[model samples]
Target: MRQAYSYVRLSSKKQIQGYGQERQWEAIQMSALAHGWDLSDKTFSDLGVSGWKGANIETGALSQFLKCVEDGYVEKGSVLIVENVDRLSRAGVNRAVTLLMQLLDSGISIFTFTDNKLYEPNSPNPLMDLMGWALSAQRAFEESERKSQMILNAKAKAREEARTSGKIITRRCPSWMQVNANKTVFELLPERVDTVRKIFALYINGYGTPRIGRLLTEEGRKPLVGRAWYPRSLSRILQYRAVLGEYQPTLNGKAEGEPIKDYYPAIITEDQFNEAQAILHEGGAGQGRRGEDMRNYYAGLLRCSCGEGMHIVSSKVKGKRYYQMRCLQYRISCFGGSWNFNKFASFTLFALRRLPLLELMGSRDNGNIKQLNDKVIQLSSRLEDSRKQLENTINAIAELGLNELLQNKYKQLTSLIAETDSQLHAAKSALELSHGQVAIQKEDTQMLTGRLLELLANTKDVDSRIKLNQVLRRYLSKIELEADKTNELRYIRIYRKDGDLLVTAECSHRLNNALFYGSDGTTEAMELVRE
Candidate 1:
C-alpha cells in the first residue's frame, strides 16, 4: 500500500489549545483511510510557530520533513497531507509556490483537506493547479500583512496616547515598579525600591558591578526577579532611565517614540543618576577580577606620554618584591622608562596636598561646562531635524503608500532621533553636575579635599585603594607621565576635570627627592626652567 505523511501547524499557543491541531489530524486520517493509504505514525507538527515569516519551514517541523524526504526516508510517490496550503506556508506567492514545486519535483503528492484537492507530481492540468496554489498563497499573504499593519497601528496609537496623557503603555516596567489598576501610573514596590537605592549607593561609594554583586550575594540579598545577583544585570539596572521616571517605548528593538518624562515615579534623583553615569563613563570603578587586594590605585586615571595606560609591573630583586609603573605599550615605545610606584605615589600625594583647592573650586570658569552646553545645543538641533524628517516621511507614506526606500528611511530617522535624544540627555545631566561643582561652598570643598587626602595617604586595603581611585576620577582628569632623559627626571602633569593645568612636578629617577611647580613662581624646591 502507498504511504501517507501528515503535516499540521498552528500559528499561536492559543490555537494549539483550540481544536486546530485535532481538526487537522482528523482530516488527515479520514483522507488517508479513504484513499487506502497506510498512514505513517510519525507526524510533522509545528506548534506555536509562525508560517507568515516561514519560521515553520526554516526551523520548525516542516524543515525536518523536507530533510526526511531528501534522505529517502519518506519514499517516492508518497502522499503528504496538510489542512491547507497555508498550513504548509504563508510566506508569499513566490516562496510558497517554490516550496510546493520542490515537493512535487521530489515525487511527493500533496493533498489539502480545505479544498479537498490532491496535487500530484505530474498533474494533467498543471497550469490550473498552479493558479489555485497561487491564489491560496496570495490570500494568506494578504491576511497576514493586514494583521501586521493592524498591530503597528495599534502600537502607534498606544504610543500617542502615552505621550498625550501620562498613561502607562506597557506593564513591563522596571523591576521596582508596577502599572496601577487604571494603567495611568506606575506604583513603586517599596522593598524593590530599597534594593535599587542600595545598589546605587554602593556604586557611588566606589563599588563596581562585580564587587557589588558579590557584596549583595554575601549579605543574603536576592535580586528583584532572579534567584541570584549577576554583575551584568546589575549594570543594566544602573543604566536604566526608567529609574528617573522616563518611559521610552521601542518598536522592533529600536526606540519608537519620544521618551515620556515623569511616566513613572522617580526612584533616584537626576544628580545621582548623572554622577553614576560619569563614573561609568570614566571607567573609574575597578573592573578587575582580582581579590580584595587591588594592586593599581591609578587604574583608569594614569597615562603615559605615549597615550597608553600605565599598568603596574612587579619584579623581585634579591628576594624582595618591588612595584614599578610601566606603559602598556612599553615594547613599542622607546621614549620613557619605568618609575618606582612608591615614589610616584608619594610625589602625587605631595602635589595634591598643596593643590590650592579653594582657588580651583572657587573659579566659575569651566571649559568642560561650556563644551557640554555646546554639545547639548548641537544634539537638540539634530533631534529636531530628525523629528521633522520623520513627520514628512509619515506624510509621504500616507499619500504615496509605503515603499522599501521610504520604510528604510523611516526606520533610520527613528533610530537617529532616539540616539541623539539619549546623547542630549547625557550632556544636560553632565552640564547640571558641572554647574553644581562650581557652586560648592568653601567649607564643603575643604572637607572633601581633606577627606580625599586622608584616603590617599592611608590606602592600606584593596577596598580603600579602589574607593580612592573612583573619588579621584571625579575631580582629576588625567595624570600624564613624561621622562626627561637629559635631566634624569620624570615630569608629571596633573590636569583638573575642567581641563586646567593644576600643577607640574619632576622627580629624580633614583626615587630620592621631588620638586613641584605652580603656574605662578611658587615652588617647593629649585625651579628648573624649561627650554
Candidate 2:
C-alpha cells in the first residue's frame, strides 16, 4: 500500500469562509480514498502561518515535514497530499520551484486534492507545474502588496486624525497610561504613572541603568512584559520621549507616521528629559566607555553552547574595557555566559596549529572531486534513461492515433527528457569546476599553508587577528560550543567547509585555566587532551 502524508495550511486565523483547514482536510481524505492512498497518521498542518513568508518553510510544521523527507522517514515512493499548490508554498517562483524539485527528485508524487491531479518525478506537465506554481506565487505577491498599501493608508489616516482631533491613535499606550477601546481617550494609571516618575527621577539623580534596574527589581515593580527588569529595558524607558507626553507612531519599531506632542499627561518635564539624554550620552549606565573601540574578529563563526549565534558586547571593569562573545538570546532567556574574545581567539589559533594542515586540505580537495564524480555518474544514468523513454514514447505515438491521453503523456516524457538533459549538462560543468579547483589547490598547497601559518603566528595585534579570522573562516564552516547539563562549557566542535566535524576539543576556558594555573605556570608544563 502506498503511504500518503497530507499537508494543510491556512494563511490566517480569519480564514473561516472558503479556505478553512477543515474543508482542506475533508478534500484530502476524499482524494486519498479515491486514489487508494493510505493516509498516514502524521499530518502536517500550519495553521495561521502565511506560506508567502519565506520563513514559514524554515519553521513550524513544514520544517518538520522537510526534515522527515531528508531523514528518509518518508520513503521514495511515498505521496505528499495537499489541498492545492499554495498549501505547499506560496513563496516566489524560485523558492516554490526549488521545493517542488526537491520533493519530485526524492521520487515522491505530489497529489493536489483541489484539482485531483498527481505530479510525478519521471512525468512533468509544463502547464500544470508552471501555471500552478506561478498562480500561487502571483497571488501571494498581490496579497502582500495589498496588505502593505492598506497599512500605509491606515497609518496616514491615523496621523491625520491625530493632527486634527488632538488625540493619538495607538496600539498600546505607555505603561503609565491607559487608552479606551477606540484609543481616542487616554487616562493615567496612577500607580504605574508614579513608578514611571520615580524611574525618571532616579536617572536624573545620577543612577545608571543597571542600578535603576536593580532598584526596580528590589521594589517588586513589574515591567511592561516581564517581572524582572533588564538594564536595556530601563535604558529604553529613560531614552523614550513618551514620558514627556509625546506620541510617536511606529511600524515595526521604526518611526513611520508623524509625532504628536502633548498626546498624554507628562510624567517628566522636557528639560529633565533632555538632561537625562545628555547624561546617557556622557557614558551613563547603558553606554559603554567612550573612545573605546573593540573589534570582533570571529563575528560570523562563533555559535553558543545552546545553538544560538554569539554576538559581541563590551563591558567595563575597574576603568578598563573588554569585549566578549555572548549568546544573542542571552537578553531574553539564554543563560550561556560570555567568552573572552582574546582567550578564544588564541585558543582557536592553537588548535589550528596542532592540526595537520596539508593533510586536511588534500582530503578536502579529494572529497570534492569524488562527490562531483558521483553526481556526474548519477545524472548521466538518469539522462540515458530519459532519452530511452522519450524515444519509446515517440515510437508509440507514430503507431497509435494521437489520443489526448497519449499526447499528454508524450509531452510529459519530452519535458522530463529536457529537464534531465539540462541537469546532466550542469553536473558535467560542476564536475569540471571541481577538477579545476583541485588542480589549483594542488599547485598552491605549500603557499596556502605558509600564508595560513603566517596569519596564525602574527595574530598578536588586532589588525593581524582580523586577517587571521578572515582566512580561518574561508577554511572552517563554524565552531559550535556545547554546554553540559550544569551549564558549563563541555566541548567545542569545529567543522570544515563541507559541514564535516574536523575536531572536538576541550572547552577553551578549561584549557586556558589549566594552562595558566598549572604547576610551574609554564607553557611547556601544560598538557592538552582531545576528545
Best by TM-score: 1
271-303, model 2: which lDDT tens digit per residue?
566656644543452222211112655646788
Off by over 4 Å in 1: 180-185, 225-227, 287-350, 358-448, 451-466, 473-519, 525-531
What are the clashing pairs of model 2? none
Could you estimate the TM-score for every candidate?
0.75, 0.50
Candidate 2 residue spans exceeding 4 A from truth = 16-19, 124-129, 163-167, 210-221, 285-531
The stretch of ten residues in a row with the least summed lDDT in candidate 2 is 285-294
List model 1 lDDT by residue over 504-528, tens digit each: 8877766567788876657884322
